[model samples]
Target: MGDLTLHGSVSPDSLKEVDQFDGQEMSAAEKARLEQIVWRKLDRWVLPIATIFYLLSFLDRSNIANARVAGMQTSLKMSNYQYSIALTMTYVPYIAAEFPSNLLLKYVGPRWMLPTMVTIWGLVATMQGVVKTYSGLLACRFFLGLMEGGLFPGLVLYLSFFYPRERLQIRVATFFASASLSGAFSGLLAAAITNIDGKGGRPGWAWIFILEGIFTFLFGFTCFFILPNSPATATFFSTKERHYVLARLKEDGAVSSDDKSDNFSWIEVLRCFKSLHVLMLTPVLFVLGVTLYGLAYFEPTIVAGLGYTGNKAQLMSAPPFVVAFVVSMITAVIADRYNCRGFMIIFFTFCNVVGFAMFYAAKSNHVRYGSLFLTITGCYCSAPPAITWVTNNSAPHVRRATSVAIAFIMTNAGGILATWLMGSLSPAPNYTKATLTNLIMSIASCVLACVNLAYLWRQNRLKAERRQLMTQADEPEGMGDESAWFVYKL
Candidate 1:
């Protein structure tokens, strides 16, 4: 079936299509045990594969920063400001097509969708190595972003099918930490690739894209056999296991079928825009996205400006991202254990606020660098949990899909703003404007976090009041979904 026809609320007809063998339902305890085993199996294959794919995607896209320092600009005769435009072009399509791509994923399926994207972008990445002029480079980067847009939102929707809302925080975190891994790895990879001297006279930066793109293309083709579409159609698991997984999901009030969500309500797309939680959460993610892209798009340039050689700057860039990855994992595990998404996110945003102030106020190079480490670590550490909470609170099926896609779409739109904030006109050695811009973004994120906390608290209070007035026989199905419920976690 086409993807657009593969989702929605579970109608009787739809349920019949997905109903498992024996028509037997298991107890809650049996469900729990099966979930444990399923997660173990999932961790073995799902997390690692998804994480690696995103890591490579991130690395290939952002390595241009490292390439800039590796003499890419000089070789191509592009100015510093032109580099920023190149970066902005990447986000153009990435933001424009994000939500639509999720809708498309309904029919295409990840088995085919993800790999096709990977293959397309991988080819683009390889072509990046061959670009001889500024326009050529811009064209490659724009196409790269266009192809990569579907990946994140699609994966977010895909993960929702297998994992319930409560268990998804750390899983999402694990996936997002791939960005930090890429941040660290990009430097090392660029360093190695920069050393490659081809007989054809291509520069090392070109080789970076070519080599990374090749792996991405190959991995995409491979994921077809590996990435499960949903509990309904997962090929790796036994039919009974698939049935068990589906039943467990019903317990969470998350609905699924082989039908497209667009079949039910196109207005559902706008529903996400109207949610208070979404409105507040989107800007918080927006600020963080800006910071992430700012760093990803320009970290190598910033490091190079610090008086280190290109190679040394790339090497130094690894440590801060390493710190971020470790901190992100720790935060994820803690948030999941406590079921306290809001508090942890606010805490991390606060850390960024402090880190940014420290960077802006500091005089010494050592102090400034230390502040940079803290800033990157804290903001990145919080992002996954914040995003996970936003997506999980949404309704099942298409609502969840649209909500998740909006979060990414909104966030990458901020990438465009961040790109413009640190214009190429700034002095090379001290990007005073960029540093201050990050500080502003950090503060903005913190403010958004607090606003969301308050909004969630108010909604919960209202819901509690509504419950108090309801008769025993009369209650709305606990908000939107039948089994899934939203509680303010702050």
Candidate 2:
């Protein structure tokens, strides 16, 4: 219950001593009580803000699809190819900005960085309503992507600083489930907002952007005052609670040497790139991104193709995502409780394969609609674990930041590819070719997940063997998953 002294900087050596003290001195019940207090505070203050931020981020990014159905494409005089290019443009800057933004988040701190970025993107999202030309729309979309890119990976990295690997999956799933809920909310909101189709001489599509953007901007500004940067700086916690937070994290092997350092290291960046797990896992995420983004961007349109149009199609889009949110949270809890991330990932991916295949081959509209539910459930459930896997394995703040960024960049690359792929499914009434392509991607993702699972199992076995030989003192301080005593959550 003693406080670790605070200073201008916390050295690795100091953190090591703190880690040792917390591990050896604290009794089991005392430790558990302190941990409960820390978790309750975090659940109250941190998780809700991060979840809401991401929900808005996704709503702003994907609301364009709803806008398109409300006649933005025709209003802007954009052809299918032009509209696709606008979507592609968003990913270009989005993919590029992720790594640098994550790095920046470390230096600037989440309190300032997250809300600032959200505000910028919110303004940009609002500007979409004013775009008179296709070029204007493209410009707005690109800027929106650039600003929004950092939030997801940044939140993931930020959450890592708070939670250990085993507990991280459920928290991440909760945040991700917000993204799914955003999809449902966006649909319902768009359906309602589009009802103001001709008010104030503006189309309903324009109104969608205007209203949602205003909501985002205000929320972002408010978050600047509310969100805490880290456990050390969080004002809501008592001194003892803050000490407990740091102690528990250190004992859980969550903190790292570079965590408090402002200096960026190229060596850490190179180390992330060289990791075999990261290299293999990036492609799996990439494929998932393709299907995920493609579906998010076009689910309304797809539902419209199934004989529902306008407001009804928008309303229909909500149910699939609602189902996805429920399924994702359930799967996340199971994955975390059982420590079975890889198996769960593979299982969900296989579900996607089945769903997509049915969507492609089924002759009945009801069957295809049911297939949407399956596909969304599978994709949404798998994503939290997939991203958490990278964060769970990568050591130190720098490597985790770089690895998460790289994974997202590659994944967003799939999104860039999806814009074109989904676009090519044009002549819109029936997207036979697009459905087949997504089916193929889902199958590929399942194959890769199986391969990755095998690799993780092997890695865990090796680590277990190594752990048997090493004494507790042999474990490296703040090395996270790379520590001799650390076991991969497989």
Candidate 3:
């Protein structure tokens, strides 16, 4: 056995049939170099495309907040409740479509499904500019939700097919940071777009929708050409490179037997529901969702309440999200390196608790405005790690897909409460009710995260005990994270 050779002509499928390293043995240094090459290639091919698509998806979904400040509510003659209803309408279809969309992503490759969804949502978002009545606004939002619903969960599932659990946190964080970037960029973009008021016989809010929608629409077409289906089938790589990448993933236990097939299984779906961890984690995501979506949709409004009305408020919203983007990346790197997803989630959620507590009790506008940094960074930081925690634990292709869908559905369900709270508290000058609601939700999120951490620690202890009684050879293949050899990362 010597160093393995990667020629341009070798097929990826042929490598799967071999013993992986049967004919060739490489030195430890060579193996490390090969893995580095694969990772760098994947980083180039997958991460950027997914991050850009999510940025646009979030920008399209949450731009209503930007539009609200720009006069969409008044232009459509909508009350706070009606505007909230319109916001709520987006999540109704969004929630309904998540499970089915994950299932559909299994049938239609991500190359097609993800981009198609983005394109449709972009068109719907654009139509929002033309709606004259509140009913029309509601209709457009519903369709927008229907189109955008699958993207986040779909991307989560898609990434699992490529990276192992330990390496996944940073990639998921990189992808999710796009949402925070969109928050910051939306404020700056909205401030600029609002200056286009009365252009083309349209209000500034209408221009905001039309222009952002066009950018999203164009980006979707670009993704079609760049996004790969899987490492085995990626066209951008040479045949040998593809083969090496897929083989490495299998050696790492990142690629399971179920991942090789596209067949739908009812048994796998049932298995997803039976997992005690998933059951506990679902509600945890729900609570985190309440804090995250609440802040995302209303942070600008909260800023406006500090006496910076109109465009200044929109401009002010950028700083908190900028802080969130920085904190989320740093936390993700530390979580991945230390294998401490659970601890990091609890720490960040506590940051939210403290931030919101200050916001609720503060009298000065400056103090309240400063509190935004803590709240935004904490909420955003906890989210990616929490999501990665679930994906890392769920095994087999179908189970992972179904689990992610369930988690996202619960997350979006919180959006319904968030929008309603914003509307209900709209009449208050200080936004006392909304701030209090966020403070309570942040505290609840921290408690739930702590509970889940305890549960995982117990499970890990039980697994260690069982492992001591059995040999490695006794473990079965393809059991995914549930295999006796597979220790849970707490």
Please state every model's RMSD to the true fold in angstroms: 3.7, 3.8, 4.8
Which residue pairs show collisions in model 1? 3-106, 3-107, 5-259, 5-260, 6-258, 6-259, 6-260, 7-259, 7-260
Instruction: Please write out the lDDT profile of model 2 over residues 1-490, one tens digit for every residue.
Output: 0011111212335444433343466566765777788888898999999999999999999999999998998888888888789999999889888999988776677888999999999999999998888888989999999999988999998888777678899999999899889889999999999989899998999999999999899999999999988887889888767777775566555653343322456877887878777888888898888888888998888899899988999999999999999989998989989988888888888888899888878888899899989888888888999999888877666677888999899888988878878786545645777767777877787788788778878877887787689765666544434555555667
In terms of lDDT, model 1 sits at: 0.74
TM-score of each: 0.90, 0.92, 0.92
Clashes of each: 9, 0, 0
Model 1 ranges off by over 4 Å: 1-32, 256-264, 471-490
Q: After aligning candidate 2 to the native by TM-score, how far in Å is the CA of 336 from where it should be?
A: 1.2
Score candidate 2 by lDDT. 0.82
Q: For model 2, what is the alpha-carbon lDDT of residue 370?
A: 94
Better TM-score candidate (1, 3): 3
Better candidate by lDDT, 1 or 3:
3
Decide which is better by TM-score, 1 or 2.
2
Q: Output the lDDT of residue 213, model 2.
A: 98
Estimate every model's Cα lDDT from 0 to 1.
0.74, 0.82, 0.81
